[model samples]
Target: MNLFARCYCRTYQKVFLLARRFLDFSEPDLLEREGALKEDLPATLKMTGLDHFFLVISKFLFDKGVHLEMEKALKERGIVLTIYSDVDAEPTFDLIEKGVSLYKESGSQGLIAIGGGSAMDTMKAIGARIANPKKSLPKLGGVLKVTHMPPLMVAIPTTAGTGSEVTVAAVVVDKANHDKFSINDPKLIPDIAVLDGSLLASLPKSLIAQTGMDALTHAIESYIGHSGTKKTKKDALTAMKLIHEHLPSFYKDAKNVEARDAMLKASYLAGLSFTKAYVGYVHALAHAMGGFYGTSHGWTNAVLLPYVLKAFGKSAYKKLAEISDHLALTGKEANPQTKAAAVIAWIEELNETFGIEKNFAGILKKEDIPALAKHAEKEGNPLYPVPKEMNAKELEKILEETMG
Candidate 1:
């Protein structure tokens, strides 16, 4: 990185960190239990005085009828519910616009998103559009662009990843331009977050592995980043510890209620950490790849995380060593470099166990490396507060290694 750009990025991050002290970064009201969705969600909605609301879900979950009990409960309470399940794995601007139209036409006063990150993100983006009718979605991109609070949004995450329930970010794809970006603001945080472990019992093992790794990535990145507060660091460490102990057990047996609950708590803690401290190069690169190839965000993060950390090298060694100690991955006598290597090796081992490929290889086109690097650099610099500053050329070198 150039001297001028490095200085500017550091200054920008410092200013934001100082300003954050006065901001209200509140957590959502939690409804955590095995049957919260069916037993508690409806009554919670009634308490909010929401006579009508949109139930946002993915098509897969909708087809499975996973939310039937919740729907029945809402109907019994005389609360009008409009189901919108057209959300895709990677939500686009066009998709959000359609959801916004439906929301306005249905006279819905609130939103309840049930599914993975995509559904929650779609609902958040839709709420943003409805709140700020005059601003285009693209204009709402970057930090603090949302001037108005979204609707009374409730996020029920079926998968333990993305942490969209508590985070201040909604990632949206611009398919026409082949770009992906986040709409970030405190107002985008959901009013309530429901952690129902029963909803995750039917998830595929592959999905559990990917999303669990995604949560781990959030924890690691936030803990290692330059912008983390003491609270964020502690939250990240707790999340990492929970995931270390529970993710593998949950992956082996999806019906393990205790493990499932632990993973959910880990994911939420990771969200709370990253929403304040923010993520780094892995997320930036993952977003670029997802935009161009429509890759799964969690899987992409899983693949890119080790590579990014390795690239961070000595800059990340101390923090990574601390993480290794926190997770008890290495003995107390291990050197910082050795402990850092242990952390990376542990991630690689988990990926291998989950049947995740070590490299993009055949999936990533060599010709697109330049553009991908540019996109990552644009998204990361002066905003992410990464452990080590990297320019586009350096980022391109890292991308080349991922091709294997």
Candidate 2:
């Protein structure tokens, strides 16, 4: 088979897996098992009392008949369905503006977001602006900046990465500023989410590995981040175990529906964990790298994971020990302070196994360090708890080490 044929065949496999997952969607009596699904889908979602939902998803994730099934499902509930199928990476302001305008024109009362982070962010932004037309997109940031949002928002992540489906924060790149600003409003949280592992079986192998790493980082960083609470810790520990057991296989055999299913489930759990606990400096650094160079979010995260952990590994040893044990990288006599070295080594090994070049200078320039460091600190400093307390010079050292 030609390259295109090989790719198409894999996509076909992914679709078949998705169809099977649909069959398993929920024997959950929505009433009796609401708590169980809440782990997969949150219960904190506030319904805005909207009549219909507009789906915002990437073109790639739109299948031949998925929309028809969704529409049929909504219609049974008296909800109309409209779709805006153009969400892309690093969502620009124009995209959000366009989606919001379309939602208003279609009179869409709520949003259903599918695909990855970009689509979810766009849908959340549209829902926010649709309910409050007066505020400019740039005007809303920080806590509770937007008070009102559309009645219902459902986020279903096709990729097992990004955790954008459940998180209260929405990120968009301000191209002018060359930075990503997050809108951290409780109202931005989606009311419903569907994590179907079948949706992930067709993802490109490179993406499968990269996004899987992103989910792993979410689980780890949340466990050690500033906002981590008892609840977030519990969720994150479980998320870590799930990923540790499944991510390797998912990467090795992308066609393994069982591995794909576990990955999707792990991603959902990680998303929920991070949504409450928030992320730490690894994400802080990755976000800055993405804004400055337009680097791929997951690939960038994969590259930075070890170095960022190394930077703060001393202070974070206690948490790292737990992860190391979960990953089975430990010696009897090794203290967590020391055993964490094994953890870092294993992460580097995984990155190498996944074909992510951790040593290369990824979309970064030495000259850009001062600006990037400042922006990273500005953007992520608020939420990261286990800070290594880095300055521009220190950040330059980190970039220098990572580049090597």
Candidate 3:
């Protein structure tokens, strides 16, 4: 058979595998048995900031709050919990060092990270460092570089984006050099993921918008990216459908717990999809921009999503057209380019609905375009399954357009 046929065959096989694995998803009775394991002494550590916020919220909600539930659950199991809050956004090498220092000082047996991607990544770095005490984080960059297994790590994501809670990757920055790199290891996937929407009720509107878009991007990119498998496509499409249905409503009505729960579930599904299929140009560019300017990843992607989708063009539009249908944008506009334009237009409209900017003018420097394009290409090519290979010159033009 031809290459395309072989790829489809593999995809079908994966779908069957996924169907078999779906049986494990129903575990209604497992929680009570876990209560039996309370004999093990608990030594859990999570990062600082959101935990404090969670504590304050826990007071009003009592047992309903995530922090309170966590404390109660740990207490039942006899686990001592510590909060390491020195972690900051755009977790630099220095910040990771501080976290590692704290983790060692605390001598915690396990980790419970509560926050956005930054806190989770910092916690992952510390877990890896604690497992392999002598190796530096920079040395752990790239795929499966971390051979040592970290302690039991549970992730409770406060934000509904990044899917870092379920993914097997951790990003760390070298602030001195404006370089961002990742540690990709299957072992890095969190042992537990808490998808409690109540945790997200306190998020600001801007955060809700940006992170929702981030989850949407993850689903779209995973669906259209070259690395897509049958299983990843299913996950991505499900996530896309959820985001399309609930994200805007959740953004407008933050108190809607049902919408919040759907968004969080969508984020988890998107995260799981991308972990296997990987992301493409949007994430590559967002990572570069964040590393260079300390910009927010979700907001950066929100700004660049439409432009990148347009550039993806014929190379990826077949898959994107399927996504347009998934978004319920079906009509007589059967042309691939037309469908792609419709998808981009829908995203542009979504951004406007959320008050996100269409340009990167103030955030991007003119002189830095070449460097930014070069770095983005270096990070994306061969690793990311970008449907169309983008050269520096072409990417420079995109940067210029983004600056508009």
Candidate 4:
């Protein structure tokens, strides 16, 4: 990046960080337990006087009947439920519009998203459309465009990643343009978040590994970013510690309730950290890959994280060293560079342990590098507050490395 542009980006990030204090970045009312969905969701809905609400879920979970118990409980409580299970691995503007139409026709007064990041993002985008009928999804794509409050929003994360349950942003794909973007605003934060550990029991081992690494990426990226605050750093460190200690165990044994709960909490804390501090090239690149190839977001993050950190080099040494110390991944006597390298090595080890590919060799086409790098540069630049400023050419080099 040019000196002028780099200075402008840093100045913008500093201003946003300063203004963050006055924003209502509140944590959701948390209902956490093994059976919160079946036992508590109904009662909570009744208490909130929501007679009818939209229940957004992924088709995979809906097909598996994972939501049956919750549906039965809601039925027993006389809380009318409208199910929208069209959400896929990536949510698009058209899909969100379909959901908005369904929500309006169903007479739903609130929204409850039950699945992974895609489902939660779908629900949030639907709410954004409903609240801002005058603005299209593209127009609402940047910062704080959803000026009005959406309907009462609740998020239930079935996966231990993405932390869409507590984030202030909703990622939506524009399939027509083959683009992915985030609609960011404080109003998009969920009013309630249900952390049910039992829901994770059925997740595949690969998913557990991917999502666990995704949470870890969130922590590291936010912690290393220049926009971090005291609270964000504290939360990020705590999240990293939890993921380091529990992710491998959870990956090996999905039935471990304690590990499941800890991972869920870690994901939430990572979300809290990154929502304020923001993520950098890893997320931007991952989003671009997701938009183009329909790749798994968590898996892409897991693959690109170490490479991006390595690219950051000296700029990220101090923060990565702090993370290494926090996770006890290196000896106390290690220098900052050594500690940072250890942190990157740890991420690579985690990926190898999970059987994730070291690069995107077959998945990412050579021809797509320029477009992908451009998309990543556009998404990241001013908003991300990365420790090192990288332009399109620089990001393309990292992409080339990932292309193997």
Candidate 5:
């Protein structure tokens, strides 16, 4: 057998082995709040973020049943809760400052972050700022800059994407500079991650689609990135399989609790994968594009995923082939390249089914292409072990291709 054939055989065996182990394996200390919002809100709230916590949330969640239930429960427990629901998608530094001010003013002893990546990220930023009051936000960029850990920070993901609940990094936009930055530190990771399906039950289908795709991007990019380890790859593979099988169902029926639960689990697994393995061009560019255009972060990620995978090509063939196999996108007889291409085609088809746009024409500016490309490059280098290192010219072409 040739190199391709050997990889095929190995992947085939590994798939079965992983399937058995993946189902049996347990994650470290997760708070599964399936009916916690309805049945045990006070206990759940206290268990996760502790009493007197600040809830950094989105307007959607704030208006929804989850926050209401939480408020009622916490109030019953004599737990004074402070809510800051002014969080915007792809949150800016100004937003972070606003949250910080609220957190301090509220005199909350703990933190509870609800909603998607933006909410969680904003909460994380607030926690970081409180812990490192002397350091500016910009000074906290890059890896492990957090000297103080936030008090009892808990993350409850309303959307099954971004995996911000488990990740050690938070992406905060500098809207003034028309760019984005990250706060990377192990301390930034939430003390607890509460996966509550009730929180996601009323999520809009568009949000479900966007956030699901973001989780998919996280799993795919982590699996294919050069930094992937044996453990991370296993998590990524399990996450991809779960996401591929369940995201569509969850998207179609927002009330499908089973599907929502699975997707949320997948999101958590993907978060674990990417936090350790790291993401690639998809995230790098999505961050820049989102910052510059104020586009939806997950939508940009959904649009750019296939293009970035295509760029990875042979460099990520083995991993892509494995993903294709897990998703049943290709036959065992297929070569690695063929399997990889099939995965890409499947992704494109998936996007089409969900009505995601392939082009970024409305979102991209031709003149901003250079800046976006350079920004992506700055983010991709050193931090992310992308399969391919994209230079400015190459990235510009990508931006141009994405342009309408």
Candidate 6:
């Protein structure tokens, strides 16, 4: 039988190639707003991998009437549907505790998270607890502990940043500890991510700016960071290209469906890129800012992105030059590092246009920088591939310079 199978496999290689081309390539239309996403909810369900309908929670997208669609669909499938509408800006351990109990009571087989990054990430954690009921929240701390998550999970992002849908790491704040902890595990990757650009139509200009910039930072940093491979660089670069083409237009016209769709696509691409490549100094510094100031994630990234570019240009000179050519920016003659500085200058200009301030020097005292820097260092300093190791003093300089 084995010999026959091998002979048949060899005989069918060409046949299989021809057969594979018959596969369907048409995708379910991803809608832009709640009405569109709702009208097309059945199609989204068709793409989902989960067997049993379970609890569904929405954050910003709730008022869009997704709740009714989910309730109706789940009930039709004879599955339970429970909605936890309130997902905080930065979820704490307490949020996990509440979500776990909600899952326990609902007895749902899977979870559907429809919202921005915070809601999406919180739902991921909620799914984790339901999968591992006996373990307390603290046990799941740090990297690689949970063996398996729910059999299926689907993420729908209403916003264009964080890429939380595709990312494995979820940041959960420990309010009592006055810090944020990383939930690092590849298993947590959402089985499916639904990025609907039409949902971005009503987004306020402020959010549009913040999330779009966050996506840009993800693309640039992921491409430059050494954690990535050739494939990672491609994904990041593609993401960057999308941003260059569409971000300014999206900023100018928040309701432009074409630009909105492109921005959303860029965010998803950046998420996929960074999921493997990992982010660099910008994210590390942003993470610290998030912990210290409870600042908006996009705002932190927006403010710190230029500084990180400067730092990376100092080290990843050749890579930065490549990026400069890729991005088509003027640079110092014969200096690879100049390209990165150009990148920073571009970011600074964007910041000024958006009226986003970037000064941590006054906000964080000298005493705070050491702890933040130390925590950042411990979190994986080498991830950035930064030219020089920034000590407390050096980090302070970055912070001071950023205070405009």
Best by TM-score: 1
Q: What is the lDDT of residue 280 in candidate 1?
A: 97
Candidate 6 local lDDT, 131-249, one digit each (tens):
77776566766656566564466677878877777776677888887777677666678766666666677788788889988998888877766556686688787788778778778
User: Each prediction's TM-score against the native?
Assistant: 0.98, 0.84, 0.84, 0.98, 0.89, 0.84
Which of 2 and 4 is ahead in TM-score?
A: 4
lDDT of 4 at 15: 87
Model 1, global lDDT:
0.93
List runs of model 4 lying over 4 Å from the truth: none
Taking the tens digit of each residue's C-alpha lDDT, what string does model 5 give over 1-58? 2456435544543453344343322233467868654345467655554568888888
Question: Candidate 4, residue 228: CA error in Å?
Answer: 1.1
Highest lDDT among the candidates is held by which one? 1
Alpha-carbon lDDT of model 2: 0.72
Candidate 2: which stretches are off by over 4 Å? 1-51, 63-65, 75-78
**Which candidate, 4 or 6, would have the higher TM-score against the true structure?**
4
Model 5: lowest-lDDT 10 consecutive positions: 19-28
Query: For model 3, what is the C-alpha lDDT against the true structure?
Result: 0.74
> How badly does each model clash, as a count of residue pairs?
0, 1, 2, 0, 1, 4
**Candidate 3 collision pairs:** 42-79, 48-85
User: Model 3: how far is 211 from its true place, Å?
Assistant: 0.7
Question: Candidate 4: global Cα-lDDT?
Answer: 0.92
lDDT tens per residue, model 3, 189-246: 8776666666677778998999999998998887887677798899999998888889
Is 1 or 3 the stronger prediction by TM-score? Answer: 1
Candidate 4: tens digits of C-alpha lDDT, residues 64-91: 9988998899888888889999987678
Q: For model 2, how does the per-residue alpha-carbon lDDT over 166-198 read when each residue is reduced to its tens digit?
A: 777788888988878788766777767776665
